[model samples]
Target: MESIYLPTSYRSSKNLETAGYFEKYSKMCPLTWGGSSSDNFCRILEEMALNDFSEVDLSALGASCSINKLQLPSEPDNFPIEVPARLSTKSKLDFYYPVTTEATQLNVIKCKEALEKKWIRSEFKFGSKRSLKLTITDNMSNHFRNDILPGTNFIYSILIYRPFSMSMGQKHSGEKLRFAMEIEALGTNLLSQIIDAIECVSNYGVLKEVENTKVNLKQFQNAKQEYPSQTVFIDGVFYNDTRSPDAEDYSEPVIKWAREKNIGKFTVSAMETTLLNTLTPRIGYPYVYIHQGNCEHILTFSDARLIQPNDCLVSEKYPRIVSVCRSTNVLCLICGIAPSQWLVKKCDRFPQEKVFLCTDCCNSYLYIDGKKVGDFELYPFFDEKVT
Candidate 1:
């Protein structure tokens, strides 16, 4: 693939020397042509004439010669010096080749093309190809300044990954790109807006406290309102989502506990207090995003650029999802084919502590004629599928 050149301020010169500097000497010097031994005298004068001597008499060196008829020295057998061939050895630390900005961009383009081709050939189509639409609310529009126009604002590309472990201090292991989105309203948009745009499968997960109870998948339709607790940890401060009346401040308790333990001094604030552009977050640095109470995700700022005219003009589509991870459904342990809907725990029938089961398997294996078989806790299991 052809490498795309990035916009650069530096321009390379066509010639190293200044115009007419070396050409003047080349024409005047007799050494440039194969002249007699007496012409060596002129070479000495030519060198002096070339030097920065303003007081020197340049007319005394005689007129320049026409070298068209002058025969140059015959080529010597060892005229040009030859360099010893060195073995091309790389250091052990040099795992990857040093790539220029253009090369890096070309590699990225090729990878994207390959991924697109794979997506086209794959069986799963709908969820993997779909984009998340960000509806612009009236409140969001009200905050937009009249001075800041559509294309002038700074844009940010955020890459979010699924947290491998629930531990806050532990580094996220493995490579799993959950969401790749672009947001244009950096100055006007609040951190709360960005938090609201983030969607996770755990938000729709079912929770059951009682044992020997049937799990209802339909109950998740209104589960979002029941679990509105979310918090974003950026820099050293925690930004809590306090939009909903029932929304719990997950940061306050953590901040208080941290203060008590003398781990580190941290502050908690509402997500609406800070603007996206104001935060000086380092690109590729991992940040914590907790939503639906305990479901955590690692968020990182991938790239940032000024909004251009080619970008989407619609103000409603500012926070647009450009790329998404392919949907991967968790299969039932018993059936091994159907997607799991229920998570059964503490049952003697199952060997493991917890096992995923489809609705049909859960109904048949766990229950007998509409009555619970044993003391097993049942909860609805939401797969990692984005749809």
Candidate 2:
């Protein structure tokens, strides 16, 4: 297999000069107004300026134009024109705008101007497809400078991986990106404070269970009360969220199991006291996030950088989500259109052991005359959509 190499300047917008690309390209290309043929081009332009347009032979000048005779590079034979089939299913957010009409060109210019004046004060990188960067509005920056106390802060880009399912694990990559979020926080901020800001889809699952009469609502309410029983496994230690009185030490069992297997001793700490800057987090390394009693997610520190002048300066809005992935809904298996509300397990009627059904299908298929038809377990199914 042949690999195509892209220059660092071409791959990242950060490395490129902050000038018009066309001007740079023209300077680099010898034939484009920079070569010996420039004199002929200038003479033609001078002639056009002096002569009347109706009398000038435009066809003769067009034939003599140096730009028309310029040779351009052809595409490589092995260069892939179409994206790979495996990557076709992946979703992407497009930031590029094509100049199709004068109106559209004006709109693009206005959009850039808005970003410059209102949103981000610094140069915004527009070409990178893999990363999303956001900055505070100019008003927010001004407010922070005038009213807020000066302190050390950091911008963190976190990639949240999807919970593993049978299909998810079988895919090429075991980890599929559920969503990515960028947050701004002070270095003095507690780990627990940052964790609280992170909103998960599983949190909605507990509330969705209330819809199922088979399960007790009190159980879910109790679970919600114990929601702080979360842990973040960073480096070699586990940081447990023990703010609530009912918060359980979820790290004990895991540490015990690791010890039994002869793995190095792991220490557990209270997230409430641990500062965000105190921990050494490696970029792109997987960290374990256990929340809502065994709902696991792979959390990776995508980026960490010092706060800039353009960053959100409001202390109250610190640890706020700057960028988030679009929500995706899982449809019910039976109806195939409505969002799944119930999960049916160990049933003879359905082909699969576990099945997702909507409220209507669950009631109609699993019950008759206000009673369950078969000896099967029914639980509220919460789709992965973040409400």
Number of the top-ranking candidate, with lDDT as the measure: 1
Q: Which stretches of candidate 1 lie over 4 Å from their true place?
A: 1-119, 123-151, 166-185, 210-220, 384-387
Cα lDDT tens digits, model 2, 1-387, are 001222232232222121233334444542323223556565666755844544357666656674424333562334333333343232232333333354343433444444434322221333223334443353344445432322234555566665554445465744454555555556557788777777666666474423244565445433445566899997778898877887889989988997898766789898999976676665566677888886787776666655443445566666666665544467788889888867778888888987888878888888887687877777765555613
C-alpha lDDT of residue 172 in model 2: 71
| Model 2, position 298: C-alpha lDDT score | 75
Q: All candidates' lDDT scores?
A: 0.60, 0.59
Candidate 2 wrongly placed segments (more than 4 Å): 1-152, 165-177, 205-222, 383-387
User: Tens digit of lDDT per residue, candidate 1, span 1-387?
Assistant: 001221122231121221133334445643533344456546765666754433333443332342222334653334333322452332222112245454543433344444444444442555543334333332245445334333345566777666454345668744454454443444446888787777666766546554443544566644567788889887678898877888888888888887887767778788977777667665556678887666678787766655443344445555656555555578899989998877888999989988988889988998898788888888777775523
lDDT value for model 2: 0.59
Models 1 onward score TM values of 0.58, 0.60
**Residue 322 error for model 1, in Å?**
1.2
Worst 10 residues of 1 by lDDT: 1-10
